[model samples]
Target: MVRRPTERPGRNDEPDLPPNLFVIGLLHDLKEGGYSRHAWAAFWRASWIRSIQILEMSAELRASWLRFSVTGIVLIALSTVAVTAYFGIGQGIPFALTSVLWWGILMFDLAMHLGLMVNLESGELQQTLGWPNRLTELRGLAAVWVAWGAHWASAGVYVPLVLVFGLAAFTDLLDGWLARRRHASTRWGRLYDPFMDGLFFSVAAISLAVVGILPQWLAALVTLRYAFPIFGGITFLLIRRRTLRVRHTPWGRASSAGIALTVFAAALAAALGLPFQALAPFFYAAVGITALGAFVTILIRGIEQI
Candidate 1:
């Protein structure tokens, strides 16, 4: 006798299988004699449903992203107006243009990676953007402002630079605190926050060095503190096609705090006409200890992950 082809479920009088049945039956057969005709049908149907869901989610995500992008632009414009009004039109225009440029680049990059809220622990996607993420984005904009301020530090405007950066750093602490308190920690926030922190402090160090507020050696240490991890992350992503998750460590936090404190002190001292040479020892000790600790910790932890 010849073997007849197996009939696929839901093809004749059989009732359409429920989604769960599709998953369960497909999984069962997959582990047994491979995909039976019913399993193939279930798999195709399940795949179709998932494809529809993804497309719908993508559409909704675009709409939400547009709203978020518009808000960012409005805030950037307002910040430019306020800064220009206070600082005069000459520096104001250039500063505004630069801030807009930064915002555009950041927004474009985020749009390309378009994703909805992702739970920090479960890695599940959600529809809403929580306040923690909103605050993180706010901090990112503040970082752009700091970069502009850093560029102008050479003009002897130490006080303003200090104030701008101080507020930006404060937001860094605030975002994490609020995320924990609200139980709204997210993967995107975790990733974006650290990147912004690195950008914020790196600009502070390099700009100050160029302006002669910080010594070259200290600047290199600060830059390398962030540069190595960032480079490593990019390399890992390129090779593995996935992100390398580096857990926050005490040493990392200490390094960031040390850099911020050093920048604040140097800027304030310059503003007050205090001799920076007297403060050199303090800078070296703070940045040196923290940077070394952070560098070592990151290397060890990163290796463990690899």
Candidate 2:
């Protein structure tokens, strides 16, 4: 048989290509819309249009995010200073300074995670951080101050602790409701809310334990109840390269409520000069039961996600 010249793709005056080669070349041409130069021109033009549109839109999105973030930072700084100063004065200068330092560290940590404010559905930056998120931050700040002040609370100064703890508990209830009512929920709110809750209660548990309000074992259990889900979510993200959607299980909420109530009850008792130590067993049983329930339920739910 005589040998035939092999046709090159995108060439004229050549023999037709074999079926597979022809299909490949056709697909390549389709990538640019068609084989004609006009098609190629149109393809490049459309690509440029899309590129410009994306650049313009992204710049606006970034600007919007920056505005809200800056405003939020300012608000957080002002609130931290005011609250810490008010609560820390009763403790001491050192306590106030330490509280400020802790707040700074926490705000810095929050800034690191604040980039999650994008809408998961559209993958776009949210224009507004929303009042719900602002309220959540306020709640976290109050809880943090209370946790730190729990040490200085040895001076029979449980008033501020009770008030701050109450504020935290109230905001925890209100933030989600505000988010739903305003229809301003975002991926950031979903993730940040739980994280703040965990941070608040974990530190509160440890602080309460340090001050002899909660037993060591119960405190550890309370801390672990929030800690495990956060650890699991991070693990899932690292292993799967996707954000784990946090599911707010009833058990989880019940655990949080139990922990908060226990903290409040202890603080209130201390303020009233009552013997909370006598109720240690009751606190232990309640927190322990709820924590165990939340741990198992959340773990199973997280595993199901995986």
Candidate 3:
């Protein structure tokens, strides 16, 4: 027996999509008499009308998100200011400047996002803040928070800083996994996600050194490992003047994992009052592994260029 052909989606034989809630809510002001007089004509024209209506809704939603995000960042900066003032770091004034600098950086990044947003058509706007991008935003903002937290992090109060760093580190793995599973990877995300990861790790590494949890030499190694790839990619983006799609290299991934583990362990050990001297061997071994992996990644990338 022959089977009936399956109906393709979004064509004849498929049921109409439910109207967007934004459209329904938007039309609440319509008079009952008006609806009764033109309901039939409106049904025939609903598809075209709703498409335009949804486009407007998309833009409205985007505006609302932009407002929320900007306000949230401002609040973070203000809170950092209060914390800095309370902590008296850099006599309270210098750290306030740091907070300002952080806010400026955030604004610049937001500007980059806005530039991309303006170029998007209506459909792209609808999908702008999908699960993966939301994760990316979380990851990026958390990295900034870690950096700010480090500035105010005291040796006496290490636990909070450790918690922030740990959560930010988790977002790295999570965003990558979700992006792959959801097919929501964007070029901007590919660039910024690693940049944020590197930025957070670098900031955490330096903060550890500042707190004497890590020695200067080890901190240097960790910073360089993260910095090399980040600067190289930025340089490429500037020079190429086109879309750049850079995925994580295998060795790079291993390097990040190893470095994060070492940072967390070192911070935790310091917080627990464990002597850095006692765990010097373990910490150094991890650093060596991370450095070796990073070197191999660079060599592999260089070889590909040849």
- The top-ranked prediction according to lDDT is 1
Cα lDDT tens digits for candidate 2, 90-133? 54555545555655665555444444455443555565556777
**Is candidate 1 or 3 superior in lDDT?**
1
* Best first by lDDT, ranked: 1, 2, 3
Which is the better candidate, 2 or 3, if ranked by TM-score?
2
- Which run of 10 residues does model 1 get worst, by summed lDDT? 10-19
lDDT of 3 by residue, 1-306 (tens): 111387344211211122234334334422332545465355436545654454456665456456656765576667656666567655346545654566566644643353233211122433354555555565555565565555545637675578878887887888777765655555445556677777777878887787677777877888888787767754543343222335466677777887788888877776777776876787678668867887777757644543
The segments of candidate 2 whose C-alpha lies over 4 angstroms from its true place after superposition are: 1-96, 99-115, 119-124
Using TM-score as the measure, which candidate wins? 1
Q: Which lDDT values do the candidates have, in the order given?
A: 0.70, 0.66, 0.60
Off by over 4 Å in 1: 1-64, 240-242
lDDT of 3 at 233: 53
Which of 1 and 2 is the better model by TM-score?
1
Which TM-score value belongs to model 2? Answer: 0.68
lDDT of 3: 0.60
- Pairing residues by index, what is the TM-score of model 1? 0.74
**What is the full ranking by TM-score, best candidate first?**
1, 2, 3
List the pairs of residues colliding in candidate 3. Answer: none
Error of 3 at 77 (Å): 7.5
